[model samples]
Target chain A: MTNKTPLVELRNMSIAFGGVRAVDDVSVDLYAGEVVGLLGHNGAGKSTLIKMLSGAYGADSGEIFINGEKAKIRNPRDARRYNIETIYQTLALADNLDAASNLFLGRELVTSLGFVDDDAMEAEMRKIMTRLNPNFQKFHEPVSALSGGQRQSVAIARAVYFDAKILIMDEPTAALGPQETQMVSELIKKLKAEGIGIFLISHDIHDVMTLCDRASVMKNGKLVGTVDVDTVTDDELLSMIILGKHPHQKEA
Target chain B: MSTPTTNRSAKTFFNKLGIDLRLLGMIGALVILCVMFDLITGGRFLTPRNLFNLSVQTASVAVMATGMVFVIVTRNIDLSVGSMLGFIGMTVGALQVYYFPDIVGLGHWSIWILASIAAIIMGACLGAVQGWVVGYLTVPAFIVTLGGLLIYRGAMWWVTQGQTVAPLDPTFRLLGGGADGTLGETLSWGGGVVSSLVAVGLILASRRRKANHGFTVKPMWAEGILIALAAGLVLGYVYIMNSYTIAKGALPRIAEARGIELTEGLTLYHGVAIPVIILLVVTIGMTLISTRTRFGRYVYATGGNPEAAELSGINTRMLTVKVFALMGALTGIAAIIASARLGAVDVGLGTLDELRVIAAAVIGGTALAGGFGTIYGAVIGALIMQTLQSGMASVGVDAPLQSIVVGLVLVFAVYIDIVYRRKTGA
Candidate 1:
């Protein structure tokens, strides 16, 4: 891979929630337009690290740099200003709102009269969906009626709608079927082509190997290491997470 | 896809009969009551004047009920609306007595404007305090607003010393009554002409806009029929007003009174009052806000899932506070109307008004759990309640019986809502 300045650099970031150090001294670099898979077991601090980037939690120590500049993200609003968006495992979509409405959510497209311009929003949503996920067509219906993959699309659309450059996806395809998983994989590829950095946290090595350009492993709130996906196998990454050491590094 | 298809089919069926079934059921009950009363009283209960009286009578509560929809939709109850109304009305009343004479020696429109602004601001401040407690401090909305109810009403008691303050300026009286008279005034010929034209234009414009937006507009035939019916109602009202004699040969019929008396014809009570008009305008404005605005979307989203909304970068607490503040302001407006109607402000001005407003909203199909309601629905709900109360009183029904009937109706409405929700699984 060509060397480029990382889009997001988390340096020695630590977050503790009531005596529990969810993320401790984790430093990670995410490049522009790259998919970096974060592999970890349950409570391995991957989610907490991502949450810090998404402004769900404030870092107790260390710093977060966006586009090579030190950033202070106090809340989700600040995170959005830094073009960092997160889609949690729950997706955080309003079920009653339709796809177009949910995509705009709090920041809706309004007409000159200050009323929500549903037509303009629908048109924009159609364009985005067509470009990203062609299979997603339920526009008028609420997101609650959408399939798992479609709901994920809506969540992604919401982040992307706000011009999010760095996306933190928390197990986006955790509960999807085979077809849905494929759809999400294709969506990830599209996002990569759009030059948006994605930090994908998942337990599925197959997904990481199939979708990620690089994979990072974390164990017990500490980073094991980052490795190129092309040079490693699923078993190698699994061993990295479980054993907390690279096979080659041990020999070295 | 298959599930939604089947669900849509079921929804269509329900729409055919059960859509607005609450309103229909209420109307049916009202008709039954009228028939029973007519049978018992030998048709005195079936008079046109009584029906007209019912419309004017239910106006204030109906207005407050519309505001209550906003409060209830957010899954919060505003028990303080009634008290806020009393407080604002008394404030306005006190301003007319004390503040107005000291400033411009009364009879100035600016004084009324200032008084209204002061009352509304005071109500909003009170509401903001409650909203801050409920939204920021995480206090329960019910307890906060309930405390608000007691505190505001107590303030009202202290302000007026538990006595009725009256002799309100004529301008204030016009707010409750009309420009010309009391509560029985039907539209004059000129008013009838203007109202009919405005109604038709509004209906057509709305239909066209809906169609342009790809929304299903009601059939043109249905719209035309509705417009025709409205015109007929206006014409009939004009006829009734022209024919009625206030006092035998009280004055000579003037030029304006020839076709349909403008000056000496029917009193202002013969037509829609200013307060009724205010209620309609507020209801329409609020309905538009709820259905069309970005803030309205946030209101729905915040109620639907607070965590999701917050995660989506919405200021959920701020929206809650804004809504609560709006409810308070509306309550103040309602207080002004109520005070005008009663011609005085006292401690009992807004007592039990909150219960009535809440019951109206609940009966109108707003869930106490939040995220599902409309201002129109709430108004209809209030009208149903008011109709029941007025009709019962006309039949000489006792207060205890009235209470029992209202409570039963509330339970029945809620039960229907639960069953409908279960059946639809929405």
Candidate 2:
């Protein structure tokens, strides 16, 4: 991992729904040129914590520091303005549109006459998809007709294409097969090489151990601890997740 | 799975037929229906005069349906279009009769243009209200437009004070699709030739463009065939229109002044109706708007999945309002046609036009569930509908039977769509 300053820091973030804390006082930091794995069980507040940064859900209380400066992200538009992008677990693609349309959904490239420059967009999509997933070629097919892995390519392509500096991906590989996953791992490694930070919300320890430099585990709306993946074995992280107890700190 | 593969298993008979199977199926059905009607009507249905009249008849509904396709594609409906047409027709008629009776033709055509602008503005305002209710206020469109349908119909009656406004200006009536209300023969023939040439040029240009981008496009033979078919249809229309003759006394003054000595039986009353021209223009414009605009993408995306569109930072509500407002403006255009055709406007001006417009869109393969349709499909759908109504009359069918038959056709078309979807596993 690079010994550079953190790209983003979430300090004392909290939000509640219907009088219950979905996420409580979760603090996580992602550094430039590093992959931070957010590991948690379902309903463990990992998704909720990431949602705040993504601008999908505004935190009731928290401060977000980006490049050591306070930032306000009230909605998805604001997040995108900061060059932050998120690939929701759902993929969130319009089913009736072809791959090119879905890739540039809200932000379309149009000619001077204001008509969409579809040919241009498609050509650009081809270039990016070729690099991201060399096998992706369903440029004209609606995402609904595509397989799960193809859909992932579209979602990932959208986030990756638009000069993203901080990417928050939720279960991006859950639906992908091993080959596609490998393709994605390569893409992520390439992005990291370019100095972009990524927060990977994943349930699979194998992926976390292999891809992420550091792992931050959360349980019952609180952080167990953050540890270097090379320092802890899979069992140690598993215990941290299940027991909500840090490896170095004894339970209260 | 990175490679794009044609799903061989899903390639049914229709898939083998063309890229857009549903559209081809619709055209095939249209051909079959035309042939059946012609045969049953003792060949009267295919007569040039009848076909010409059918084109004029299809104009107003086709115009509205083109707009309706956009609305339906966005998962919304505009049931108020019929009433809105009637209201605007009456309003425009009232303006011609009561406010601008002194204004006549040609040099003073500016009045007509101004009136048209006013009517379009009014229609848009009306549509914006309903769109706002449905899109912003979160009221269901079905309910809002249903209310609009009734309210505007009543407004039509109230505005004209329960009286029919008649005897619109001669120049104004030309916009209604009358025999004298259209392009001159030479102009009509010229338009056909030019448009056919344009079609060829556009096709070739698009092909060249696709090649430049190294994108896959239709084969040369396929492109040739499409261009041939389009040119054939356009030229054929011109040939038929150039043959129709009007009575000498009924001929316009310009033709009489041209000093061409007519042979014993040769006074041409034939030309393309202005309304038909308007329909063509609307079809082309709507086609471009629906296929090549950011607004078009939003409409489709909003219909396909609202939640996904919302998360993608699209203001779906604003898009909905814009679509409905556009629909309203097209309805105004239809209003001009209906009012001009009748030489008057009244409460009955556009009665039941909404049904025909919606049916046209649905029949043309636009899914009521949204996210799938084409403007050209809706136009053809309108043509199919008008052909059925006209053909039934030619066959001496009773009015009740005509109604039942058209109703059945609507349902049958939708059923075919459902079956086709299932067959293709779409």
Local distance difference test, each candidate: 0.78, 0.87
Tell how far residue A31 is off in model 2, in angstroms. Answer: 1.7
Q: Write the per-residue lDDT of candidate 1 for residues B1-426, one digit (tens) a residue.
A: 469889788666545432444555655666676687777767776565565456556667777787677777777888888887887888788888777878887677676677667777877787888888998998989999888888888888787787778777766766664323333343356766787898899778767765676656566666777788768866675555444434434333322332455553443224444675677678878888887898888887776667888877788888878888888787777777777777777767877888999998888888887777778778868877877787778778899999999899889988988887566444
Interface RMSD of 1: 2.1
Tell me each candidate's TM-score. Answer: 0.87, 0.91
Worst 10 residues of 2 chain B by lDDT: B9-18
lDDT of 2 by residue, A1-252 (tens): 346567999999999999989888888999888999999899999888998998888899999999989999987778888899889999999998999999999899998989998988998899988887778877877888899999999999999999999999899899999998988888889899999999999999999999999999999898889999999999999999998878987667
Candidate 2, position B186, lDDT: 84
Maximum-TM-score candidate: 2
Residue ranges of candidate 1 with Cα displaced over 4 Å: A1-3, A130-138, A243-252, B1-48, B178-269
Clash counts per candidate, in order, are: 11, 1
Model 1 chain B, poorest ten-residue lDDT window? B249-258
Instruction: Find the 10 residues in a row with the least total lDDT in model 1 chain A.
Output: A243-252
Q: Write the per-residue lDDT of candidate 2 for residues B1-426, one digit (tens) a residue.
A: 423344443453334323477877778887887899889877877877887799998999999999899899888888999999999988878887777656564326666776678778988889988999999998999999999999999999998797999877677778887667768688888999999999999889878877888998776777877888889988888788777666567655536544455555656757787999999999988988888898888889988888778778888889989999999999998888888888888678788999999999999988899888889899989999998888888888999999999999999999998898777655
